[model samples]
Target: MKIATYNVNGVNGRLPVLLRWLEEEQPDIVCLQELKAAQDNFPEGAIRNLGYDVVWHGQKSWNGVALLSRVGKIHETRRGLPNDPDPSQSRYLEAAVNGVLIACLYLPNGNPRPGPKFDYKLVWFDTLIDHAATLAASGAPVVLAGDFNVMPAERDVYKPQRWVDDALFAPEVRAAFFRLLDQGWTDALRTIHPDETIYTFFDYFRNAFARNAGLRIDHFLLSPALKDRLVDAQVDRQVRGWEKTSDHAPVWIVLADR
Candidate 1:
C-alpha cells in the first residue's frame, strides 16, 4: 500500500493542482492538511469523481484536515484531538482505511515565538504526545502523517542558525518531537535515508525552491506494526516546482502487502 501526506494550503484554490498530483501519483491513501475551507465547501463531489472516498474536518479560511482513500471506504475514527478543552480549529482527522489507522494533523505553526501561539503549540504537542503514546501501545498499524510544522533536528532544516529564533526550530519543540519518537514510532523518511538531505517544504520567498532552501517539516511516523512493512519513503520534490503549487510537496511511504 502507498500512503501520502500533503499540505495543500487551500484545497479550493488549489483543486486543479491537487487533482493533477492525485491523478499522477495514485496513492492508495492520502492525508491532506490546510484545506482552508468550511465543511460545506469541501468540494466532496469533485474529489469523489476522482474515485476517492474522503472524510474531512474543515474550518473557514484556516486549518483543516482530510483523509482520502482510493481503494476502500474510510471509516472515520475521530475528527479532532480528544480532550481538547476548547476545541475550535479543524486540525486533526483520524480514519481507518484498508485496516491501517491513519492520524492526519496540521500542527500549529507557532510563529513569532514567545507568545500565546507558541504556548498553544506546546500544549497541543503535549496532547498529541499523550494520545500517540496510547496508539503506540495498541500494537495496531498506525501512521501519524501530516505537516508537523516542527523541524525535529538541525539536519532537517536548510540553515539551522537562520531559524534559531523560529518556533519550528526551537529547542523545546524539537524535544517534544523526540519524545513522540521515544514512544516507538519510527520517523519513516529519516529511518529510510538517515544521511540524505531531504526536504518536503520550501518558502516561496527568495527563490527558496530554486536554491533548495527547504525544510523537512511534513512527516510520517509509523507504528511498530508497520515498520517492517515500510519498503520506501520519499518526498515528491518536483511537485513544489509546479505552478501555483503549495509550499509543501507530497511525502509518501510504500509498504509491502500483508
Candidate 2:
C-alpha cells in the first residue's frame, strides 16, 4: 500500500490541484493538512468523487486535517489531540484505515516567537508526545503523518544558521521531535534515504522552489509494528511546480502487504 501526506494550504482554492494530483498518483491512503475550511465547507463531495472516503476535522480559515482512503473503510478513531492546548484549532485527526492507525496533524507555525503562540506550540507538541507514547506502547501499526512545522535537524533545513531564531528550527522544538522518535517511531524518509537532501516544502518567496531551497518539515513517523513493512519513501517535488500549488508537495511511503 502507498500512503501519502500533503498540506494542501487551502482545500477550497486548491481543489483543482488536489484533484489532479489525486488522479495522477492514486495513493491508497492520503493525509491532508491546512484545509483552511470550516466543517461544513469541506469539499467532501469533490474528494468522494475520486473514490476516497474521507474523515476531516475543520476550522474556518485556519488549521484542519483529514484522512482519505480508497483501499479500506476509514474508522475514525479521534479528532483533535487529547487535551490539546488549543482545541479551537482543528489540528489533529486520527483514524484506522486498512488496519493501520494514521494520525494526521497540522502543527502550529508558532512564528514570531517569544509570545503566546510559541508557548502554545510547545505545549501542544508536548501533549502530542505524551499521547504518542501510549500509541507506541499499544504496539499497533501506526503512521503519524503531517506538516509538523519543525525542521528537526540541520540537514532538514536549507540554511540551518539562518533559521536558528525561527520557531521551526528552534533547539527546543527539534529536541521534542527527537523525543518522539525515542518511542520507537521511525522517520520513514530519513531511514530510507539516509544522507540524501530530501525536502517536502518550499516557500513562495524568493523563488525558493526554483532555487531548490526547501525544508523537510512534513513527515511520516512509522510505529515499530510497521517498520519492516516500509518499502520506499519519497517526495513528489514536481507537484510543487504546479501552478498556484501549495508550498508543500505530496510525500509518500510504499509498504509491503501483510
Candidate 3:
C-alpha cells in the first residue's frame, strides 16, 4: 500500500491542485493537514466522488486534518493531540486505516522566536513526544505522517544559517524531533535516502521552490516493525508547482502487507 501526507494549506483554495495530484499519484492512503476549513465546508462530496472514503477533523480558518482511504475502513477516528486540555485548533487527527494506525499532524508554527507562540510550539512537541512513546510501546505498526513543522537537522533545511532563529530549526525543537525518532520509529525517507538533498516545503513568496531553497518539514515515520515492508519513499516536489498549491508538497512511502 502507498501512504502519503500533504499539508494542503487550504482545502478550498487548493482543491484543483489536490484533485490533480490525487488523479496522478493515486496513493492508497492520504493524510492531509491544514485544510483551513470548517466541517461543513470540507467539500466532502467532491472528495468522495474521487472514490475515496474520507474522514476529517475540521475547525474554522486555521487548522484541520483528514484521511482518505481507497481500500480500507477507518476503524477509529480521533481529533486533537492526546492530552491537549484546550485544543482550540485542529492540529492532529488519528485514524486506523485498514490495520495501520495513521496520524495526521500540523504542528504549531512557532514563528518569531522567544515568544509565547514559540513556547506553545515547544510544549506541543513535548506532548507529542509523550504520546509517541505511548504508541510505540504498543508494538503496533504505526505511521505518523504530516507537516511536523520541524526540520530534523541542519541538512534538512536549505540555508541552516538563515533558519537559525526559526522555531522549526530551533535546537530544542530538533532535539525533540530526534527523541521521537529515537523511540523506535523510522524516518522512512531519510532512512532510505540519507544523503540525498530532499525537501517538502518552501516559502511561496520567495521563489524558494525554484531555487531549491526549501525545508523537509513533512515526514512519514514508520514503526520499527514496518521496516522490512518499507518499499519506496519520496517527496512529490512537482505538486508544489501546481496552480494554487500549498507551500508543501506530498511526501509518500510504499509498504508491503504484513
Cα deviation of 143, candidate 1, in Å: 0.4
List ranges where model 3 is wrong by over 4 Å.
Answer: none
lDDT of each: 0.94, 0.94, 0.90
Worst 10 residues of 3 by lDDT: 77-86
Give candidate 2's total backbone clashes: 0
| RMSD (Å) of each candidate, 1 decimal | 0.7, 0.6, 1.0
| Candidate 3 TM-score to native | 0.98
* Better structure of 1 and 3 per TM-score: 1
Output the number of the lDDT-best candidate.
2
**Model 1: CA > 4 A from native:** none
lDDT of 2 by residue, 1-258 (tens): 999999999999999999999999999999999999999999999999999999999999998899999998999999988888878999999999988999998888988787888888899999999999999999999999999999998999998889989999988899999999999999999999899998999999999999989999999999999999999999999999999899999999999987
Cα-based lDDT at residue 146, candidate 3:
94
Counting only residues 3 or more apart in sequence or on different chains, how many pairs clash (N, Cα, C under 3 Å) in candidate 1? 0
| Model 1 poorest 10 in a row by lDDT | 78-87
- Residue 176, model 1, lDDT: 98
Listed in order, each prediction's TM-score against the native is 0.99, 0.99, 0.98
Question: Which order, best to worst by TM-score?
Answer: 2, 1, 3
In model 2, the Cα lDDT at residue 213 comes to 92
